[model samples]
Target: MNNKTSSFLWNFRQLKLNICPFGSTSIRRLMKVDPLKLHKSKITYQSNSLQKPQSSVRNFCQGVLAFQLEGNEIQKRSLSTLTSTSVGKLLNPRPLSFDSQCFLMSNTTPQLAEDGLKKITDSVEHDLSPKEKQLDFGKQRDLIQQCNSMSDVLDVFSKYPRFSCCNYFITMWKIAKNMSEDQKRVERQLLYEHPAFKQLCDHVMKEAKIVRLQQLMFTLYAVIRIGIPQNIYLVQVLLRVVQERINECDETSLSVLSRTLETMEESKNVDALRAALRLLVDKQIWTIEHILTLQTMMKCIGKDAPYPLKKKMELKALKELNKFSHVNSQYMFGALAALNHRSLILLNECSKMVVANIHGCPFWMLMNILQSCRKLQYQNLDLFTAIGDYVTTTFDMWKMKQVLAFLFAFETLRFRHIGLMNMFLKRVLDESQSLNQKEILCILHIYSSLNHFHECKNQEFLEVITSALNTYLPKISSLNLLKAVYCFCLLKHFPQDPFNQLLQENIINELLMSGNESSKAENMLHQVNACLEFEDTSVLQSIPITLKECSSDSFFSNVEVEDVLLNLFENKRLFLKNVQLPHNYFVDFELRMDSKRSQVFPVSEADVFVAKPDILRVALLCVPRSAFCFGTTHPRGGLGMKMRHLKALGFHVILVHTWEIKRLDMNPAVTFLKTQIFSQEAFPTATEFAA
Candidate 1:
């Protein structure tokens, strides 16, 4: 028979002997008397075995014999010890009386066996015992009956050394799961009810044996999964356990610990991990010391070992070492530099070291470090040389990928890395043929962020950017075309003439036609245009001349700009009701007379000269002024004092400032003279004017 069959048969025999102690002998005889009759006898034996226990083996034998004698086709058979062990044990040290056994055996019945089996099955199914059901219904009575204190639970769990094993863990889990609602409430209360439970849990966690430590780790995982408040303590206990296990050189323990650490990572429980690390450090755990020693050992292993094994060892060492300090600022740079120099041959080893160590530091901290480093080595040719050497050497794609991401991040924040940034950009652009859309987008985004378009204005760089765009533009998907357009537009006006004609002929028109409505891109576009002195005169003329294009449709479509301006004006009106004119408006404009106009006309019917007479008749408004001063060479034949001298010329002269007099406050003809002046000559220098 197969092992599975053998095991099943063995368990079945044990059960039979336990319930049918007195009937064995008679059943054996029935098996022998008529071998064909043994089948019915076995069925009868099974039926009786399912109920209450028989009183004695002799009584069971008598009952079976009586049944056989009644022509029940009894089959006598030898009693196998396989089916008799349980009954034999229970019947040991019995009274030496055959009659007592016979009475007990005769009384055994299938009904009693059935009832007994049902009780046992019910007990297992409901997790209820007769004693438990008899307990009180009130809260105080319930608490008094059960013992589910935190300390008690910990004590129970601490006794099991093989807690990490599946079987032991499942059992304990069932026990906890079986607790009533009241019991669970008591459990929680006991946990935080007093300082004693805390002390006990702490002690148990610290002093837990190896197997118990494994169990503790599982428990911590469970607690974390359940989102229990006790996770803080659990984390502390698990970290200590890991430290101990690592020191012991227990591979199994390390495996479990590694998985737990990864779990913590996946859950983003950095705070808990930090707390655990701090506890280990403050306690001076031997595991950390051992880890440091192992790192030294790996260094001693040098480069001669097999690459895979060496990588594994080195990675293990780095992971442990990472727990010693913040990864990004403390360890990541050195690790990256080492890999860059070829001192680290394995890319996986380098990646693990970098990822593990770097992630420990805050993102802002990493950003700060990168920024500071970028500025320090920005113009250094050696840095670029090193990067190029590293990127080209070994062809390690993983390291290259990480470096690219890192550089992208640095550039994204507009950190200074001039020499390396330029080199990297050149390299990437050169390899653009092989790059995917996502990779291209990342590069373009970083380029945009660093304002690298400004550098593209140089003749040499302009060709490169133009070439890249020409090659990639058609390949770029429609969704990303808008982004590429913005980047290209930025480059078009980057203050150089290498591509000036190309921009004016094609790129500018493309941008104007594309009509993207992104406010951010538009704003940036406008800034670029203003920086390069590109004026969108059509949009400007629509607004009041007194308002300057502080920011306007140069960055947006006419409709979008108008909507935004309307909203802005609405908000301004609501928030700044009393604020003054030009200060209140977002844009400001200054007006001046054309320098080339030798003669100017007043706003009158005669002065309204039509450039397009067939189009429409226009009227000009006029106002009277006080004084007009003419140049010494002026010829005489003027009809009247020309308003050009009164208003167009820059001078202070007196004029009557008028408004309608109302409310009977003053005489209607009382006119006040306001001194205003005009001059054709240029304003004096500061010194002359002051004098």
Candidate 2:
């Protein structure tokens, strides 16, 4: 035979000789019979060879059945339920007496010994416990009771899972949140690792409806402090409950509810804010904090508050006006502006009160009040004078933002507090380092507006501005850079050398990458206004120079003004193409009038001054849609000063517009202007006609 066939036959013969060859080793051991009995029976079997194999198989099956029955009995009597004495005896099998040993040896088979070994191993494994929870019962209870911070509570929960289900979860968090900052910081670290704390917060939120009002507030306070995830449904549920029981809430409870309402995301459930506002206002027990909350709510609700509700709120403010301090009055004014409510009566009284206490008012509070006045477009000379005097005397104490706000409001009102401006210039010299990028832009904007009346020739102010530009230009945002450059052009203030190069590069980049075309044109005009000899003109190619290109730049530049005048003259129906002109035709035409001779002086200008009459000047204006109401109506500002100067010059000025002519028929508007200018009866009483 070949080697492979020989090897296979030998392996097959060895396998056939082994006992219980079909099953695994353990199974075979359980089924095995005693070898001594089998050997003894072998001789007998040889004598009766035909019945031997069948008789051996029958004996092996009986042995397996007996072992299975004994294993079943052991399982029924589990090791956990057995007493310690039973376990000890089972493990040691108390040194069997001579008679017992002899009986066990005579009956036991290999299958019985294997079953006994399996029972011992199973009992030992089942008796062992986890080491994490090895503490005694009293010690576990004590650890839980003494828990103070999140660390203590979460640690106890880790050891004993049952402690996580206790009723004191909310109470423990309350104590934890009130701990020291250091302790809380440590606890916060632990809170992130354990997920069961989040589960506890969820449990408290779900059970909030059943808790007392104080406890509910406490729960919210703790959750907010712990920085738990905000639940919108829970907030809605709390709001509903508070609304139902609003009458039962005292001042303290109301305050807590208002704070909680403020903490919620404003875009979700704005109705809750409105409801809180109505409740607080109805109570009429106003505190400083309540007023602040009202301001926040007004901002959230905006102009959507009902008219009747607004009137009621106005009445409440008036009723409580006398009790308000400077800060409260400031808040009340700001709230009125945010809600877009007009209360001139309250404003008059509030101003008088504010003037009385102007010296003692905080700088921030005074600034807030001025911001409100600006919003209302109100011009109270006495209030302005008082605040101006205080700011002028104590200019050193004001911050840069405060100074900027004062300048904006004062300039808007046409209140040229000269002492204030001088003090402001001097103070800026000392506080230049404190000026930031935003303040720089504000300064430029105010200076641009003021330059309309007089030139900005203050050297120190210019120097401070140039210094700030050099320090912060690289970090400024693109849009703000455009605005800053525009303001600088208007004020004729440009940075020097390397900073100028950087500004040019940024402007070029912005223009090239600009997505909006209209904004680009408007920015281009400002760039042209700030024309330095060194500005890079390459970026100007992208923008088409056109008038009225953007709707936002409503106030026209010189070029736009000229274009508008040209468009008006081109309309042939007006019949004014052949009128005579003076030697110098100017945009800012000064008229000094008298029956004998004209008294010329520096004064207001007509937008398109065609002819300066001794008693009648025909002036054309292109006022923006917004300026007619809020912008030009300041008492001593642009519109007011123009009217006063026109009257002082003894000129009957005729106002004409080309933009609004589209709304009216061109023929009738032309007829109206012609009649007023040509008819001698039009100036019967030296009248100024505005068309």
Candidate 3:
């Protein structure tokens, strides 16, 4: 009870310790007893009520060892087991018949290989769940339908996950080889209507998930092979989607955007191209280095290709360029300059077509081209000449006026050509014939800016201007008299000598008459003064008489006739009596006669003659009042007294009264006394005055 039980317990504890290090007691339990023999012994013991299992346990242990050895041999033959024996040890110990080892290795190899291959095949074949299989088939059919609806169904299929990658590409290649029109149409419609197509595009773009490049190539091929139309709306939507996708900072999105740009270029869908360019500019997606490519695209789009479409494309290109606010103006300007040069070339090329199809090319088109050139600061002299020639030759007078106005407004003043100025003047003069004073006024302003006022005097030019002025002046309301005055001033300076005569007789006198009570009179006076500088005294002499009749103090007030008087005195040593002088003399003097009455002597002989009281006032004010009558009136009859004093002083007086005054006051006593005071020959006859 003590030694034997203790020994058994000690052995069992040692065995438990051995198995404990192996991390499990199952091996220890197997070593302790055979479970099959124990089960059989237990069955016998249960039947006989006794335990007798020693022999059975031995046999069971032997059987278990044999089974384990066989399993080890099988594992080694299949090459699926790792052994602790070294390679040298295993080679020397594992001595078997060559045929037996080869046969065993061969038998195990096929079964392992088959099992591995079957597992892979089964995994591939059963990858989709029941629900996924249905979904995949449905998606495949949907993609096929989409491809059939559109001629370019590959664009949609390549965008679908179920059809994208290897699947869509292989299918697209097959469809491309055997494509029918109906099939192509159905594919295209399917693509056009597929919602997942856009989603797939967005996913590839946003996630940068380019699982395959072949799909893209096939999609592009299909688009081109099917011949994409110039559908602006479709292009716009595509461009917007591209823009949104490109904003995601992904390689796939950029690749897609770039590919779209290239496709747009090939299609010559300039509107789409411009739309892409505008997106680039608006998004500022490209770095400054990439702008060169953008600019090149812009140039290609703006080239003159055809009619409304070309114009539409060009305008869109210009608008896109205008969006680059921070772009280097010099770069943009250079690009625009190149574009302008091309435009001019195009204009020349199409000019003949425009002329032939006159109704097709409206004046606005030419005007817009010219305006664009100007706005871009494109100043080519040859282009300007061509434009000028076109305008002058093709446009009527009214339209010519608009063209000239644009030229005058926008063309550089420093570049004003003399020939252009001359042509403009001639056109203006001709066109202005039917124009009202206001319009004429504008023409005059342009002439003035060109400094062409003196040019009107050119005989040929004068005829046109005079005709225009004469025709339009009467119809113009008095409110526009100031403008007429400017025109008159231009006419006054024309180079023709006869213009001077006409001015003196007609224009100047009429202007002076019209200016009598109008505020415009002062301006007219200025013009009259300008003429006086030319020393055209015919008008000057008429001015004094006109002033005498008008009784306008202000009129006399403004006229600087002292200079004229001095000029006349210096030139002719002559002065007029009883004629108005401009107010404000720089010098004043009194003349005295030696007598008991102390009469003021005349400063000059011309100051002593008189014709009427108003004229007398105008002329006598140049000298002191004592020189003529101090406080005398017409009834006082100072003429006789003055003549007697003059006769006593040994002077001759001219009886210069008007015929009306002479006929009324002719008394023989008074006449004889006036004759004694002055010689009869001193008085001129009315016939001489008329002459």
Candidate 4:
């Protein structure tokens, strides 16, 4: 009998390995079989004369078998080390042969050891009480695999205690749902509404004390993926379990738990998030997955990580960066960008890796890498050019928003790629119908920023936008509608007919609702444009003179003069007298332009003279280029030609330097004007006029 039990368990070990790779470990630990002792035992049958001597060995084998079959807590405690004691050492081993191996592998179900082994397995299962039978991990795992409905799965859960097969059942549920068809998935969707599901949830919540750490993590992750709303009680229990076992979790387990918590959107849970953070902060190195999870956690907390933690993460990332495929690198770069990490060296290294792997990279990943570079303001011309070149080739493959998002990235970083812009415009024109209101507004914003309004020369693009306006304007949000109106004004063009009416109506209401004096002034300009389009001056009397001051100033006599004065008054702090030159150099001896007349002066095809405003005595010249760029060739072209003449006429030539625009605050011109208006120091000499 001892020999029979030893041979049976050995065969069962082989079968268990074949059944489940993970289950084999539990089987080995549970059986406590000594391979060396089994190998030394000689095969023998019970002889009639020696039956009396072998009764104890038979009784020992029967006692162990009975204990395993019952698997009750009391019996388990009593026979804790029974297999490791002298009882297990009495096992009899048999020699292995090809015939026996074939039989064990192929004929495992029935007639195993010629009915003797079958009797042992049958007796072990059939003789157990119903409650003890639920401890059978193998049978429960099988039932979970074969589950066809939510009720079937819930039934399995009901049979076992909360912790017994929670992990395995949840995993199997995910696999079934993910692998099922739409109809089958709909069938499984019933799980969320099932009463049994609520019962199971309540069970876990009430009995969370019995759960293990891995089981808790797995259960939470499964819940998140299934799109169930988590119970607050369950979440509290999970966090408590994590707090208690924080020291016992290894790096891999910690990474998984943090990622699971993030999926749960519980990163804002102060206690739980900090517990995971403390464990991960000290690690010197990490796998690529851990690097991804660590950065995600950093983003969730939305604070700068400690110096040591950040340095270690960068070091680990640098070492493993080369080994990551493009997808993983996308995750890495995006997470780093999300955390607002500013490691230039690692960014440069990642750029090189991305460029090298550009062929297989998807548009979204490429966009992510570019967006990261834009956010960090990390400039790598080679990296940008590589991605730009790829985008050029694959331009047609991207969707409308993707193309626009890609363009916006470049626009924000001030990296101009003209060819890519052309491709993007062509795609947008072709796919305009697919665009939504938000997308159209975005495209317009991008185009306006790039000064690509000239590309709107395409009649097809114009027609598409014109067509979309009717459908899009009413639905666009207020902020974006304001932006769209601004784009139209910036382009100095509006769409045709009914679309234009819709746009104008929205714009008028938005501007009036703004309550800003400038917004009312802006509305006057739109009205002026409408009146001028019809060549109707009958309505000009209704236009307020103060509103006329905000109109676009243009000098037909001096083409560059219009832009300078327009930029000067753009700050809206001080009013300016628009300067006009004579149509023929001999027609007017002096340049004198009135503010009200200059408002409509740019509309004339021929140059005209107008009187100066009473408040203007100074001439402000805007030099768009830096003084350094005024070389010998173009010396007298921009500011040099105008500076001397204006100063000779006794006007203070206050030059607005366009090259210093970035360094200037919101109202540098305003500040300069205020200083000039109050200061006792006289206007600077002509030598200082080139400022």
Query: Top model by TM-score, which number?
Result: 4
Off by over 4 Å in 1: 1-259, 262-406, 412-418, 425-430, 451-479, 489-522, 528-691
Candidate 2 structure, TM-score to reference: 0.50
Which candidate do you rate higher for TM-score, 1 or 3?
Answer: 1
Predicted candidate 4 versus true structure: per-residue lDDT over 19-133, tens digit per residue: 2233113222233322122234333433334332221212212111111112212122121121122322333211111110011112222354446444444544444567776
Pairs with backbone N, CA or C atoms under 3 Å apart (clashes), candidate 4 = none
Worst 10 residues of 4 by lDDT: 95-104
User: Across residues 15-117, which tens digit of lDDT does each residue of candidate 1 receive?
Assistant: 4463344554544211111111212222224344445434442332332221111122322232212222333233122211211011111223569645544
Look at candidate 2 and tell me the lDDT of residue 435: 81
Clashing pairs in 2: 489-530, 592-599
When summed lDDT is taken over every stretch of 10 residues in candidate 2, the lowest stretch is 96-105
Model 2 Cα shift for residue 293 (angstroms): 8.7
User: Per-residue error at 571 for model 3, in Å?
Assistant: 39
lDDT tens digits, residues 1-691, model 3?
A: 5544554555456444422233222232232211112122111122243233221111111111101113213222232332233211211122111221121112224576466445433433344356645656457756665563332444654444443333443345456557777766766556545554444433332212233343443343343344443232223233333322222333333333444444454432334333434333333323323444444444443433234333443444444543433332223333444344444433333333334433333455545545555565444445455555555565554455576665554333223344555666666656665665555666554443333433444556655655665665446544344444444444333323323333444554565566555546544454444344433335333333243223434333212333333432353233333332232111121122233212223345455433322221111122222222112211111222223233333333343222222333334334542332234454334322211
User: What TM-score does prediction 3 earn?
Assistant: 0.25
RMSD of each: 28.5, 24.9, 35.7, 20.3
* Model 3 misplacement above 4 A: 1-366, 369-380, 389-433, 436-439, 453-457, 470-484, 487-691
lDDT of each: 0.35, 0.49, 0.38, 0.50
Candidate 4 local lDDT, residue 2: 59
Q: Indicate whether candidate 1 or candidate 4 has the larger TM-score.
A: 4
Instruction: Show where candidate 4 strays beyond 4 Å.
Output: 1-138, 148-152, 159-163, 172-189, 202-212, 266-270, 283-304, 319-325, 453-460, 470-482, 496-510, 514-691
After the best TM-score superposition of candidate 4, give how far the Cα of residue 683 lies from its true spot, in angstroms.
26
Cα displacement (angstroms), candidate 3, residue 46, comes to 95
Give Cα distance to truth, residue 24, candidate 2, Å. 48
